[model samples]
Target: MSRRIIACEVFKPYLDKLLEESGVEAVDYLEIRQHDHPELLARSIQSIIDETKDVDEILLFYGLCGNAILPLVSKGIPIKVLRVHDCAAALMGSNAAYRKRFEGNPHKRYHCLSYGERDDEYFARTSPEYRKISEEYGEDNADYVFSMLYDKFSTPVTYIKLGLDGEESQIRRKEEGYYSVIEGDLGLLRRMLKGDDDHVCVTLHPHEKFVGIYDYEEILTTVNRNHDREKTREE
Candidate 1:
């Protein structure tokens, strides 16, 4: 069977053009908009739900709304929310609530597609012609390619360890393997810690291997130890 799908968009006409060009036989489109501020994405989704009541599935390309939007969209529609984005790419996904506004067509099946994944599949389909990128820039260049593709979807990772060598060393440090007067990347670790504590303080020596296994507990302990050590020397 051909892919029967009713697609939703804040702008309906735009969606129509896309369908014709792409040759998607089973797609329905809806237009959503708000004059006040585009940031109020919830309103757009509300429109979809009101306009569309009997959908089998919805395909949305918007924010990854995390856990926030699911409750509202599911309240009115029984169909599954189909979210799509590019492969680890710039276009991640939209909140599900925005999806609720669309009218569901029982004839359509639900699925999500991201250009990012399709792009990968496209290159893979191209084969040796696609392999030219790897031949020219090397495999490591794939990160740059992914980075470009995921630009819409990517965000900065919060808990980053600056200089850890390997996993074995990390597990050892967690197991108290650095038992005695040990040197480690204390200063860098301290910078990484979030909470302010009075109990622990840790010193980092430049020569020591940095361990990344330290969770919130280890992070706090390191901070507290270093805090006291500073005071002891002052006294």
Candidate 2:
């Protein structure tokens, strides 16, 4: 059966590479652009689900994403989503791997993104971007927007090094904040694309709400219970 993956635009490059490398045939994608808006994301996801009613085993390349997935349980179809807080964990392959980076540093406000995403003006928040936002919504509104979203973060925006060079990394860093580098691997993404196993994934059954899954126990319980359900269905 052909599978589908609805992913965020931020993960487009990574997902493209993983799917290509995995050689997973007949897989389709729907990329949503709502990194800053969770409501739109939820609506987009539901629309995609409605559009792809015939498709089974749909994969979502999303995390809790500010509770956007809270309302996106199952709409009578089986789907798999990573047990992660955000794409940061997906990029690192797992929550443990993503958290391991902060074992020593322990910066809660740490933000990670791909180098290619640095150019998105929506994420820029200054210069041409800020001017654009200010013109469209006024300077006061712009400040309010930034304050509500990005102001909470204090540490340098950490860029996940994914085979990019130092100069490119430097360009991606915002001038107002500092910069740091960390290695990233697509192991989890590859596994998902390759359909190797569900070790790092949780399959949601019909009508099951995806509240959140923070630890291995949560993942195991959800996945294992789903496995049993599948077995029962087969029987």
Candidate 3:
């Protein structure tokens, strides 16, 4: 069997390009890529289960906003890999309140929060500016966003994209890690997904490696999808 790596929404193209050069097989590069947020992610995760007839290794990318990742960890997956990334502009202006919330739970799992204002508020929560952002968003801004990020990060994320499915996703899972789902068949997924063998396949990534992240800009120069440039301008 070939060592597969499935790239989610944002990282799919870059991974695809790399494979083109590496002569690597890119499976569900398109399948698992998803929009931001927890609900979408959960749906996407479920879809892979429904589509893939076999279990396989998966590589999943994630921001620090969803809360679902934690639950996925508790559940069973072959080998879950969580991608973590932090943005530079997002780190500015935060208060101690934000730090206390996230920093206290440092031991569980730490990944990049993606690049944006949300992550900025997330990182600077303890910097004294956190409260200000939270005040504008809410007292629980960090907690809420973090939870959402993890939700999308975890599972049940929906496929907001066009032209993707389970088999393609499996190919990627076999290669890269998607969410908490590692590469495994129905038998292995039964323990966690609670579905029939014919129903779903699991794609798991190692949180250690998944959580381990580098600058995305460095890897892919042209990664503009799903994210709303207009929204950024509005913010």
| Best TM-score among the predictions, by candidate number | 2
User: What TM-score would candidate 2 get against the native?
Assistant: 0.73
Question: Against the hidden reference, what TM-scores do the models get?
Answer: 0.24, 0.73, 0.32
| Predicted structure with the largest lDDT when compared to the true one | 2
* Candidate 1 Cα errors over 4 Å, as ranges: 1-39, 65-71, 79-235
Expressed as tens digits, the lDDT of each residue in 131-233 for candidate 1 is 6766788766754564444333322211112222432343343225211221212231121121122222222222221122223323211122244567899
lDDT tens readout by residue for model 3, 1-235 = 3233433434443344445655656455432223345566655554553444344543333323243332333122343333222211112111122243345444322222121122334444464455665777886775666455453343322112212233344334322433222121112212212222221222333231112123322211111232356569888
Q: What C-alpha lDDT does candidate 1 achieve relative to the native structure?
A: 0.30
Worst 10 residues of 2 by lDDT: 216-225
Q: How far is candidate 3 from the true structure (C-alpha RMSD, Å)?
A: 20.2
Q: On a 0 to 100 scale, what is the lDDT of residue 14 in model 1?
A: 31
Model 3 misplaced stretches (Cα beyond 4 Å): 1-4, 29-34, 63-65, 73-77, 83-235
How far residue 98's Cα lies from its native spot in candidate 3, in Å, is 17
